[model samples]
Target: MDPLHPTVDPARFAPTLDAGATFEEYEALKAILLAGSAQFDVRAVGEVHTARPSFPLYTASIGSRDPQAPAVGFFGGIHGLERIGTQLILHYMRALLFRLEWDELLHQQLQKVRLVFMPLVNPGGMWAQKRANPHGVDLMRNAPQRAESGVPFLAGGQTLSPWLPWYCGRPGAPMEVESAALLQVVHDELASRPFSLALDCHSGYGFDDSLWFPYARTRRLMAHLPEMFALKTMLEQSHPHHAYSFEPQSNQYLLHGDLWDHAYDHAPPDHVFLPMTLELGSWLWIRKNPRQLFSRHGIFNPIKAHRIKRVLRRHADLLDFLTRAAFAAPRWLPPADRRMQLQQLATACWRPRRAP
Candidate 1:
């Protein structure tokens, strides 16, 4: 579904942050950070200023400070309307805090891997229940990368107007503050490690949930295809009937300025960085409750409490799986001798078509 053809009326998106109006989700997120401050290092990486107030962009981490340990990042709320994405990461962080008090094994696991959290990246947009930041730029589409060809009009990206959806920022302009802050966090933490994984959660797409890897700017296979295939093999072997579809983002559609693509492109070759986006399927929610199509927020998030709880539970194990995968990457990552075999398998699975 190209967001270029919005399901709901456009006027419904015109709301802005009003005087002293607090974003309840942001307040709840801050409380979670404060409660875990004793266990984690929490600091504001940047701030997004709106007409009403300036919201702090925070990056929190806990685990070994050693540069040799593997790292994993949990990111969400890049699109403000996708509130479930932000909530899921917070739920995981809160669970970690509770476990920190009693789970000795969790502490042992932390020593082997560094876990970083930036649960709410676009607070200004989230504050207004809009997908784009306060400057009206979609953080996911605000990066500097561009597609070569065959990109859908407006859907791939554009600078036509901020009033339209999927607006990539003006040509040659600096990245939005939130986007830059995320890149800095990736550089400071994930890219510095020998092996790392990042998962950025989102919703409002197809009928089933999808796990999309890098190369949103192009359909060409990433240099780390074998590693990606190895990861997929591990998941399938571990969960034979897992519900999520694991594939490349370009398989569904292409876009400009995908942050994960930008990060993978910039990371050092010696270090392996695998970034994936968890695009939860809101269409399922709407299928059960057809009226959701009329509400902008409903189109992107579960509108009911019970449904929201189910959505949270569905992705919990996957998050834990990713954490463990990063911690144990050395055990499963393909050795040089096996790289060609796995690469061949990956090509057969992901890029099956050939030119005539």
Candidate 2:
């Protein structure tokens, strides 16, 4: 399914930051940063400057930082309007922090795994309440790779103008500041480990929430297809009835400059980097509250207080499942002798079959 990205009035999306606007999410993030600093190794990755205030891009990590330790990263807010995605990460962080005070089992798990978070990557865009950042660039599409063919018009990234949505910056231009910062975080924190998994949260798509793996730039299988399927099987066996459509982003549509694809490609050939996006379906939200269609923020976020809570509460298990999977990756990952069998299973389950 496509975003069916609703266009607000042209004047409302004039590609400028609302300097006077305050971002409640950024402020809440700071509070959480302070509260968790005692346990988390927190630091600013970069700073996003607007006309008046500059938001500090932050990353907080905990657990083992050992080079060999498996790592899991939880990221959100790459698109400003998807506040629910950011909230989900923040909720996971807050809950994890509260549990650390007494949950001994979690602490033991942390010792074996590294957990990192970049919950609010596009605060400036979020502050301005626009999907694109202040420069009007879609960070998800800012990577250097191009879709050689078969990309839908504007939805797959464009260069018509910054005024247009999903506008990738001018050709040959460097990535946006937020996009670069996120990539740097991925390289420094996630790819350094031998086994790592990154989940970047997003919303504003189909009816059922989805778990999309990479190769968004094409319909081919990812390099680590066997490992990806192994992880999927672990989740399904553990959760039994979780509500997620696990598939490749290409299964929905092809797109250009998918950052995760770049990140997965850039990882050292020996490393296993599995990046998945949790696209929380917002059409369901819009259906339940038809009035949401009129507002851009409402289109990507849950407007009602209760629905917002429901959205946040349900995803914590997924996050927890990831850390557990990472901690026990060596155990669940198929042996060299079994990789071919797992790959065959993965292809059967995910690869689209051609009509005879």
Candidate 3:
């Protein structure tokens, strides 16, 4: 038996996302952290206790340790069923570790920008083969934020029952362990800085990949709209052939308890905090491999080996762009004088509907 994925049967999943597969992810993360331990500050920020044993929620940082430095965080696996999110983050972490061995430019970049990673935030959810964590609360919907406007039925996050998908949790209860851990890391690492960005990797969206910014609870523009637009413009100028559809999350649909929305709102008023979701287009994978429709995991991940590799490779440039962007935020981020102009342009392109 392959010890890495022994707890869950691969036949019951897509090729790579067995319930037991999170074990492999955990072990690999440990090895990577060890290999770069000299350069990394790793912490077991929280734990997920269950009937069998407790699973730790680990966070790690490598690069400028100065609190004042610009920081960018990469997170994944908040929804246990969407293991590809975790995989994408792990892939980038591994690549960065190897690159650090000899990439002089990367070493220099690290001196200027802090990078933090939480590759697996919901180990219990992955182990249980569910989206919600051990207690059955969806981490994304566990944040203490409610939509000001109407939202999609059930999908908007409901307090009705834990059995229902998108369950926020018992009303008035504290946030879930996974959710709290994610926020803690953000507050201590990313939000504390003058300029910061977060990319929460996820999947199970539409036909094309997307990078969605905050204010998921309402059809409104965020304080960083100009910065977001500037970043988007930079992406277009830099990677002219890229395929991601960058926009506000509300442009597609709005929902309650969006963690990023809460995080952005709570960040320091003086800080430029831009949180985004890397919503991978899993439907493309499903459309290409019709057989993927039969497996629960297949709907959210690429089942074919080649497709998985392609997906893994395609996003590397974007991740790198984010790192470079964070490192050079002073160059691209709009200044006080230019924010209104850029905000107007951004509003025209993103939020045509004025918020009430």
Candidate 4:
């Protein structure tokens, strides 16, 4: 599809939530998309059991007629309360359908790459506006490799407080339906597809955008190190408002059964690229300093609302950079040169520290 123009307004893509919009709203939105003429399939992966109602979680695919195109999976809404990620994926999908036209470049790229989206993976948790799924399980922390009990770092972390904003869920148990369903999907479906890259989005942290790569302890999974670095550099260079940062997948401070870690372990050896988590800023649903607006009423709070709009606008540019980077890398640079490029890009984005 011809890439959507940069001048497109953010309001056009904003999701409209009605008085009682819950998982039902998500289903409604999915139906609307399926009804359209666009090429999309809504595969019901599994169902979530919640107090409100049980709902099916799905993955949506959109692309041109290129079978071998590099595939990109966009995952969000792992944390129920982190609604922005879910909205961002939905907005991106809407743009791809209504605003974008598949041109020669888009067609060729689509053939060369596939884009998969899991817009609302934790419908039960989202309905309750809680971080954990229906059974109060934190889906992100339930990955088999780093199941809370299996990983010591996550066992006694300070972020595990129930009194805190988010509860990390029962250790060692894959209690959440949402997480379990996703785990199955990755093993059954994603394992079979020639998946090239994946980006899982979240919020309620750093003010700047942070890109986290897998196996933080070992950089071995980064076969396309230079290209990855170049992609990060291009993103940072193009969007100064969004700061770029990277860390190992198994950082003690952020250890868990994270989706990225799962993707790294399960994806085919040749796929090479590890899944990255894009952590955006604090939650718009929470009232905070410099913007003391209440969560309930701040959806329309002028300043907060503007910042949300600004982020949405920036996301469009980020998508463009990602698309170009994926397509241009393997074709343009040799292995050694690609490594050098990545190193340069990494150095440019890394912030040097000064002695106090």
Candidate 5:
């Protein structure tokens, strides 16, 4: 059976974020979530200034009933042009909220797992539909990943030139406002309740859905291979079209101080294994007929639309699985080993050429 044809209401699966939509739309969505009830908490992380104007960086949390339940976070829109990421999170939220209303199973899962949605991490960059922030700094690459001279290269990578889209900012200066804000929020939240799993959504990639873990250099991350493999299998079974692959790091053709990298590095050792970047597909931004008039951001492309629906459904399944696995296991798998096996399986699914 094709997973895309599930009998859920399409309207319930629709995204709250519109393509090429303004910051006002995002604020509107935030407002809606905030006014709903005490179950959700909507707050501003900070603000970013763009050529057009400045906008708030927002984070929304759907508090779980269980205090000790593992936290799950979904983040997107780090790259301004990558609107699909934001849409994916919105779609997931919609499905989750819908299910929570009618399904006891879903309600149980929600009570067991806290979910934090950072739907638009780079609102200023997203507003212009550009990759970098208004200052032309690629927030992903601006992380303090490496050291220079005798100090950390904290603000060194933000410099912009005519040659590239990813301009890391000036050395010793604060990183882009967006990245700094997200980092602070995530850090504080995790410090209190560590996350068991996280999915940072992105698009404009290969045809298959790819899940990338920590950089290959981080050998310690190899421990969580089993859990990652199980999660990928569950996702594939729930939504078959999503071809699952795992890459250790960004390709040489596409390298940066990506958000996932920073997230994994900062998370607790056991929690570190849970971070994965879900790269959807190249088809997300274009339709079957390239010339056919459609949303410039292609938010409504028919093929992409179906894929989004499928992913949202699968995400629901994944959420249930996570709740069961985290609480049921007598002894949870260690982080490093589980990650290695996940990388192995993902290599087979994503990079068949490199499959052993």
Candidate 6:
């Protein structure tokens, strides 16, 4: 076994990821964080042990530590095959850290908004190049929530076998270590705030990049529909040419154990939490490069150097937009009367249309 991925029990599970390459990238990221340690609070929030190796999950934050401050978190790598998600976040973090040296505006923004990053939530999975963690439990489907109905068999989540994709793990088993660590980060960093937003980056679903809000377990509108609508409005107005699609995850498909839904539903009532998933469509990549369909990782990530750079640059502005949106939540979150109007509009836009 590679030193970077020492086996604890070789017979129990087979390693499928490129552990050496992934860990090397992880080391470089950790070094960058250390280099800019003075600008942020960084820590290994938790660790996950695979049969071959153990991976530390790190969460870093910059800006105010005040409980009342608004926060926005950027998460990636929940699916190991979606390497671009992790890279996008790490790239944004690098930009922020570098800007801290001279960007006084960012310094002032930090005074009001907290920024958190968990760039590699499933390093073990990334190392193995598998969607699930080392144990074959899909972290996205490992949360406790279950869909009442309308789930698409195994695609929604299943316990038939770990060998199948979208396996939710054994019934009643504890959440995976990476999943728990992510939830803990949300609880500590964003749950206490009066208003907060979280964006979990992912890919490999459709042809167009999409921004999906909560209630993944059902098609029902969430309690914060008005707030979600307002944010969508603001984002549209701010970036008129942005091509990303925005909707509830259920619009795509109902699924069990969506972590963001679990977090949003369980957030403090006094606080308004809006968690989103940025699913960068990979079909477009495959369409452009037909050969990519043959590579597992290629289906979920942009493989060519130029394409990868384009993907990063395309989403960088949106990440910055979310940060600024968090800072301005008080200004645009909608007043009581306006919220009702937005709710009606949200229903018209997002809810499934009834037969007329």
Going through the candidates in the order shown, the clash numbers are 0, 0, 0, 16, 27, 4
TM-score of each: 0.93, 0.93, 0.92, 0.74, 0.72, 0.92
RMSD of 4: 6.8
The residue-by-residue lDDT of candidate 3 on 9-117, one tens digit each, is 2222223344343466666766666665656677889989865646778887888767899999999999888988888888998898788778999888887788899
lDDT tens digits, residues 1-356, model 6?
Answer: 22111223222223326645446447656765766566667778888887676777877788877789899999999999999999999899888878878899988899888898999999999888899999899999999989855688799999889999999999999998999999999998998789899999999988999999888788788999999998998989999999989999888788999999899888998789999999999999999999999999899999999999999999999999999999988888888889889999999999853212
Q: What's the residue-level lDDT of 23 in candidate 1?
A: 75
How many clashes in candidate 1?
0
In the predicted model 6, the residue pairs found to clash are 6-52, 17-127, 17-128, 17-129
Model 1 per-residue lDDT tens digits across residues 294-338: 999999999999999998887898989999998899899999999
Model 6 per-residue lDDT at 280: 96
Best by lDDT: 1
lDDT of 1 at 273: 95
TM-score of 6: 0.92
- Report the lDDT tens digits of candidate 4 across residue range 184-288: 655544444543556777876544456777653322334445555655555667666665566544432334456566666767775545367777756333434
Candidate 3 lDDT (Cα, 0 to 1): 0.85
**Local accuracy by lDDT, each model:** 0.87, 0.86, 0.85, 0.58, 0.59, 0.86
Q: What RMSD, rounded to one decimal, does every model reach?
A: 8.5, 8.3, 6.6, 6.8, 8.3, 6.7
lDDT computed for candidate 5: 0.59
Q: What residue pairs clash in candidate 1, if any at all?
A: none
Error of 5 at 119 (Å): 0.2
Error of 4 at 284 (Å): 9.5
What local lDDT does model 1 show for residue 73?
97
**Which regions of candidate 6 are displaced past 4 Å?**
1-24, 353-356
Q: Which portions of model 1 miss their true places by more than 4 Å?
A: 1-20, 352-356
The Cα RMSD in angstroms, rounded to one decimal, for candidate 2 relative to the true structure is 8.3
